[model samples]
Target: MAGKLGRTGRWAWGGLLVVPLAVVGFAVAKPVKVLPRLGPAPIFRLVDADGRAVTHEQMRGRPVLYSFFTTSADDRVGSVMTRHLLALQDRWSRGSPDAASPTPLLVTITLDPERDTPARLKAWAERVGVDPQRWLLLTGAGLAVKLVVGTGFGVYYETPPGNYDSRYVLVDAAGEIRAVYRGPQLDVATVAADLALLQREAAARGAARLAYAAAHWFACYPVR
Candidate 1:
């Protein structure tokens, strides 16, 4: 009886080890990559350059990359963010279009809404030569913009905006904020990688979903 009990204990331990080993393998191999779910995106209703109401509900099924900018000419943060996003836009557009996945939207919300009118935004979009359909330049009421930029995104904003930090929020298709990127420098490749991972994670199902879920838990994102 003692011998039989010893054998059962060893088997139980081996069974436990198998699951852990598999988990370790999954982490190391990283077959299906995913970005961590940050939190629920702030509910917002802002207008675009075309004077159309662009609400959170409208953005529900599409991934949106959001940046806050001011019309201030000397705004260095804005310059860097603008260039980075333009590069991303070019890169994304040049790639073979994927009909299965929803086309991503790039949004730049002006911090100086008092002056950054819809017409101003439209002119800026044209000046930059960005595809107006894919990239939207947005401006709205002062209180509304403040609410979305400060309360919603938790970024600093003051009138006559003197140098707001460069930050980008990546909100996923299901209306969840997946990643927040900060700093003056932008890595287009890494951002591209993260976006790809997000699109893949969104379409994952069955065992693939489970693996992606695991990656979402363990991975810090921008995983190759």
Candidate 2:
């Protein structure tokens, strides 16, 4: 009777181990949805630094890092943030030769449209060493779009007369607004890590889609 009890205890312990292993295996096999396949991205019809009309549809395929700020209120911190973003763009652009696609797009939309004119944006770009082809400084006609986009991305700004603050928004490749980096004090390392995660997520999704297509094709022609 004692021998029989020992054998049963051993089987129970083995069963416990096997159950968790099976659960882990099943979880590993499950597919993960990288980026929310959120319906079409929000539309924006803003004027670029060159005074040309640019739309959200035109920027679909590439990831966009958007920084929204006012030039009039605390240009020093805003300019510093812009320099960091430009540095990031330079780093990524340098890796383009090895990458499947070129550098990601950067757009700086001004909340203080009244002051941030095309000429001012051009000067700011030159001061920060921003590439014209990769970085765009956008300004819109009315305050309504600014409020709408800002609120949607959780960017809080109180532009009462004679006082202002800063807010930055980062949009991913799928055009989905992924993060809102607030305040004038921006951490460069944190921003870089977020951008890296976005790139990895996008690449993983692309790879999964390609694999799915290949599997579907093979199913139609088995033993090929």
Candidate 3:
């Protein structure tokens, strides 16, 4: 009887471990999809590389592609990511003569305020080929606020004294959080494609507004 009890106990312990492992495996295998939509995006204020205060409210009426980063030891991925962002900004800002309206706005917010000063951010921007008119790099005061915003956007960052991970977040014009890319998981081609979608959306919104205005004006004049 004692021998039978020992065997049963072993099986019970093994089942306990296997169940949680299966659940975790299934969760990892599931795919994540981020839908593109317009809504009131979360609000935050930070000082830009030019020492100017920038807020989400100021970015309203325009599509915003927001990227969040920290200047910690794990910032090696940031240079490459920034390059991709700058390329998209250049492409969108130069209005296609064949196309109507301007492209979306690009905003980069630094998570490490203690280390990423205005001078440092400006130098980084130059290194990453950021255009002053199109791309704005910002930094904030405390980690608490940054963490709260980052969490709200589904961006994760870890700093183990000397090590860190870079994360990026993309927000749309209607103030809605759209996409989040972490570390080296993102590529230049993907970033460009995402920006193109945003540009098209912005153009459509602009056209709708112009049409409404024209209709109102024509109604008032009643052309003979």
Candidate 4:
């Protein structure tokens, strides 16, 4: 009788362990949850390096990655980030021949208008090897640009003297601000993963949003 009882106890214990594991495995298998939307992107019109007018309307229906920088010699983060943004496209957007679509466009706006006119931006673009087709270098009325970056995009910056924060803003296809990265916190892998998640969410027709909300409710963020 004792031997039979021991076997029964062992089976009970195994069932207890397996039940929790199965629950965890089910949670892990759920669809990826995305970051919550930050806010609506601000409206603005600016000129690109090629002297063409660029507006928020034109950018609609496409995801955009934004960064504010100056042509000033001290702002090295701009160049470093430019390299990272380009790599983001090369690594993730350019998938196989059957890739669905290219990655989001990277928009770099100059905080210094006096020094970063369209002509100057064009020169800087060439010097930095920026592909005009993929990356846009924009400069316009200092106040308008400042308003768009500061008030519209919610990025902090000061004009005239041209001082600004080094940060990146990721906006979804619907012109909603989604993710923001700053300073050393920027991670290429994280950004790429988030962008892919956003794309999937946009395509999910409302089902993914509910799943994401459930994940958030359960505090199901991935462990580092």
Highest lDDT, which number?
Answer: 1
How many steric overlaps does candidate 2 have? 0
* Global fold similarity of model 1 (TM-score): 0.86
Candidate 3: which pairs clash? 41-175
**Per-model CA lDDT versus the true structure:** 0.81, 0.64, 0.62, 0.75
Expressed as tens digits, the lDDT of each residue in 10-115 for candidate 1 is 9999999999999888777877666788788888888999899988888888888989986556777887788888887887787624567887889889988987
- Number of clashes in every candidate structure? 0, 0, 1, 0
On residues 117-169, what C-alpha lDDT tens digit does candidate 4 reach at each position? 99989887788777776688888987888788878877677656445677899
Comparing 1 and 2 on TM-score, the stronger one: 1
Instruction: Name the runs in model 2 displaced over 4 angstroms.
Output: 1-41, 96-98, 160-165, 205-224
lDDT assessment of candidate 1: 0.81
**Cα lDDT of model 2 overall?**
0.64
* List of clashing residue pairs for candidate 2: none
Residue-wise C-alpha lDDT for candidate 3, range 1-224, written one tens digit per residue: 99999999999999999988855653444221223443446677778888888877888765566676654446666656666776677666666322553456777776677788888888877776778788888887766435545555545555422334455666665677655667545565665556555554455456564543433333322111
Residue pairs in candidate 1 whose N, alpha carbon or C atoms collide under 3 angstroms? none
Query: The CA-based lDDT of model 4 is what?
Result: 0.75
The segments of candidate 1 whose C-alpha lies over 4 angstroms from its true place after superposition are 1-13, 27-31, 96-99, 219-224
The alpha-carbon RMSD values of the candidates against the true structure, listed in the order shown, are 2.8, 9.9, 18.8, 6.7
lDDT of 2 by residue, 72-175 (tens): 53567676777677676777666642276435788777777777777887777777687888888888664754554555444555553133345566677667
